[model samples]
Target chain A: MARVHDMGGLPNQGRIVMDKDEHPFHADWEARMWGMNEAMWGPDSWTLDWWRYVRELIQRDDYLTRPYFDQWMQVYAAMMVDSGVATVAEIASGKSDGSRPKGAVLMHAADVAKAAATTRDFRRPADQKPAFTPGDKVHTKTLGEGFHTRLPSYLMNKTGIVHAHRGNHLLPDAGAKGAEVAQHLYTITFAGADLWPGEGRDKDRFNADLWESYLERA
Target chain B: MSSSYDPKKITEIHEHLHSELPSDPALRVKALESLLVEKGMVDSAAIDAWVDLYAEEIGPKRGARVVAKSWTDPTFRARLLADGTAAISEFGYQGHATGHIVAVENTPGVHNLVVCTLCSCYPFALLGMSPGWYKSQEYRARAVRDPRGVLKEFGVSVGDEVEVRVWDSTAELRYLVVPERPAGTEGLSEDQLAALVTRNSMIGTDRVLKKAG
Candidate 1:
């Protein structure tokens, strides 16, 4: 739902508070929420993109009203029940009568260091020749509706130039479906004026990551 | 395994979740976590470790060190600008999000700002979790649209002659702004220079200011 989260360019989002000393988590709940999320997610299980998609799936009102970690809490609860790791009663009562979560890739306390270093390298050798090259003009294709997409709504159908070839990587659109799809990724540079016509100067630019599927030769 | 959506049951769960959820959000979080532990989904100690890793072990200071080194060392700066993943790994700061970091230098003619616009896809290992505003809908909405206006609101006024480049970070590549070194700080040590670097400066929302004599 592009109702709330796809905030690329609409305006009037009051002052940007500059807090130089900001910590990662403001409240203990936020930290624990992060921890639980870290523990629940394993390579064999869900990808962060899937979790992000679920976050977007949250109801609009709750998405806007609830604090960040609170949103995570709700998502976690839903995941537990949805995955059959826990039931509604189990979550409500704050105790678990459920069986050991099947197919869970266990992450122990000692494994935190190792886990921190592990990141899914999206890059793979090109399946075919790269679709576009640096300096080539292209346009973004506004594909897929009602589901997760890395292609921002603001960039849809907009023109950009391929700034750099970021090699082939697992496409998030296909990865969300557990497809492990590989495609060429490019750093597409959009003239700020093109994205926000009246507001941006000619020299200003916005560079975004674009998968091959999301772009076409201009 | 039953990942089907049951609206009615989900509603009940949501109601109970919010209603019975303890007033103290932290305790409520703990309660939910304990339940997960009981269900054998997560280890309590592991949770603590993960939290500590983010809260303590990783942060902007590492990025600060990188920036300081880059400012003083031209070769490292070149490497950082060319291949941030390999450059940063020399400092022992290598991990998932650090893979494809692209260091955009702040030149006299151009200034760069970083935002996800889609989601908060930041370099967590180098810069730690993003500030709250970095993930805000307003910031996300406005950053790409009215970057100069956004900069103005952040108390950063860009000159007409200078171009403002906004980087939308993705999971594959992250951008770190190597802020232009302030004048009159030629004698400062690398560590002292690192101390002057703020998270916002690295994110390109604010500039690193020089200290008074």
Candidate 2:
């Protein structure tokens, strides 16, 4: 198998586990403060070289004192501050007026009204009936490989049934950022044995939420 | 497989993922961070209006439904094995896979589990949101290390002769495991079969069909 990182080697490093070291707070207090989600955020994708150098300066052993999400936040702040992307002062101040970028907020509300009209609302009536309907056979497109979607890479170009047709959605992708992203998303399902015959359960299957733009019925 | 990444590479990639944001960074950051806070992430709600315009939505209570159908429908099962995405839609759920979306079957002699060694990769359509456990290092580690041991904790224990396989989900496509039916479930409707197959079963933590003594 062409292992993504370690592939399927050591479960501790590779598989998802919540144990001692895996604990965000369990690492060196310094490491924790530096914001290393360890498994959650791998150095492979991000050029940790910047964060790595700065983190090493701390001589204290990594600390084990918090949860995974907390560590993620710490890292987010650290990066903006460390890279001059945002300064430590900015993180402390929580505003970007002149020097720092303002931090974002997350809230729980079903209504758009809950969203202050003041906040920039990017949502448009992006819903569109899928070109393919339920039962329609479709194929994911693998056209080239520049950043263009939020669909998992593993599902591209593969053929499967149209499991669902959720209304319009946005593509959470690097290039698809901003008003330029495709609007709606779709959910596609697949069988277990189909992917890994030996490993899959003959009885079970899976599906995903894909934007209409992601499909091309087979 | 361990990431070939050094710290430098890791940070670089993250910065890229961060910069990839197209929304107003000020607002987007605030939104994501807000969710973090709500989830007890850190303490920062400097900004609001954080939800995504196009929120990803997956079906709830449907993953098992599809599994149940396949268990009872041989033709559908054949189609699913041949083309998972299409098969799933036949019952009204959509699936997407690229490069290679592999399916691992959960059974009496075999058990299958899925995880994103890369990040929090999951098939949202059928399974809805991935449970916190699926995203935790605890699950990833145990599933690969001692699947049997982990399953026991999840209330599932396979035979010594049974084989277990774990899938490492990727950005390319997500993976899901089909769990076998419970014993007393025989003669039950497909809907009934689907009901018995919990998300845990698909993940290989628990097998289907076990009655309390």
Candidate 3:
């Protein structure tokens, strides 16, 4: 089943409004939320993949209706309680009951700049040969339900050519489950006509970075 | 929390209960921050530091500088296209949201556009926070299917002869489009050229740059 977050290629979305002078955050709380998110990044905290999975797990109605930061706020709350750092009661009342989670790595104020400047390397040493290389024809596998995947549903079962081999990177499917499984990533290029049929233009194409597990020999 | 505890259900209940009362996101965020701080899980100072860093130091200007240098220097342009991460690191702009960068250049016959269909995954370390419209559902859904239509709405009209290549950021790799330098800017300095590069042009939503007067 296609989750609400998988919104690519859907029809009748709306018009695009370009607000040239728009600020990144409209309110103070939004900025706080953004900072809070960045501050929570650490080894002991939830992985980015898990955070995205939780965001997708939000109920469809709330997912669609809530503001972007508000949705992130909900995800953070859920993750905090789920990880045992706090409780729903504690969150509701805005007070801790004197019980702190042990072994939680906290990001101190001094480490903020280093943390922001440092990039988390997701690439891992390759364990096996890459299944396909650039210029090879491949088809995306039909992803099964009930797991976090980076393969967008719109490209399922679609044939494309491997544009580039992106080396071994952590697969988000396993990363979301708290495991660090690495796989060969590829930039797959699909013709616009193949992806959208009669509605797509002939002079256009789409490229997506897909994992090896999400593709098969075509 | 028990083995049977469901976070999704709890979130639903919380939303349902909150609906009966006045809903204020600002208050909720404040409450969450206080709770996290009280529990010693997060630091407010760290949060403030992050907010200040993005607000003051990082943004599209960093990306503009990279693009401007690439426009004037063929060697830098080649390096940027060959390895975006290494080329960008020369400017000390390599950081979060830019782990494995792939810089695609826009030529006379090809135009490059970037979008994350699943989520709002952008080159935030270099480009700063994504715009509201870039994160909207409208752009995500239509960018992959109707590139011409979306570009037109952004006031960019790609000729039929040009092939529009939309990069869907589905994995960890981030894409940056090096837009073609606009015409009649041969006399401009690198700094002046950087000033003319807008954020939308880097995102491939705008094809035309502001002419230097």
Candidate 2 global CA lDDT score: 0.46
Q: Which stretches of candidate 2 lie over 4 Å from their true place?
A: A1-65, A74-85, A98-218, B1-60, B90-92, B95-101, B184-187, B210-213
For A131-194, candidate 2 gives per-residue lDDT tens digits of 8778877788764432223444445667777765544433454222222344544556655455
> Ten consecutive residues with minimal summed lDDT in candidate 1 chain B?
B1-10
Ranking by TM-score: 3, 1, 2
- Number of the candidate with higher TM-score, 1 or 2: 1
Q: By TM-score, is 2 or 3 better?
A: 3
**Model 2 B-chain TM:** 0.68
Tell me the TM-score of chain B in each candidate.
0.86, 0.68, 0.90
Restricting to chain A, the TM-score for each candidate equals 0.91, 0.51, 0.95
Q: In CAPRI terms, where does candidate 3 land?
A: medium
Clashing pairs in 1: A7-B141
Native interface contacts retained, candidate 2: 0.05
- If scored against the real structure, what TM-score would every candidate get? 0.92, 0.47, 0.95
lDDT of 3 at B146: 93
Candidate 1 vs candidate 3: which has greater TM-score? 3
Model 3 pairs in collision: none
What does each candidate score in C-alpha RMSD? 2.8, 12.5, 2.3
What TM-score does the A-chain of candidate 2 achieve? 0.51
If both were scored by lDDT, which would come out higher, candidate 1 or candidate 3? 3
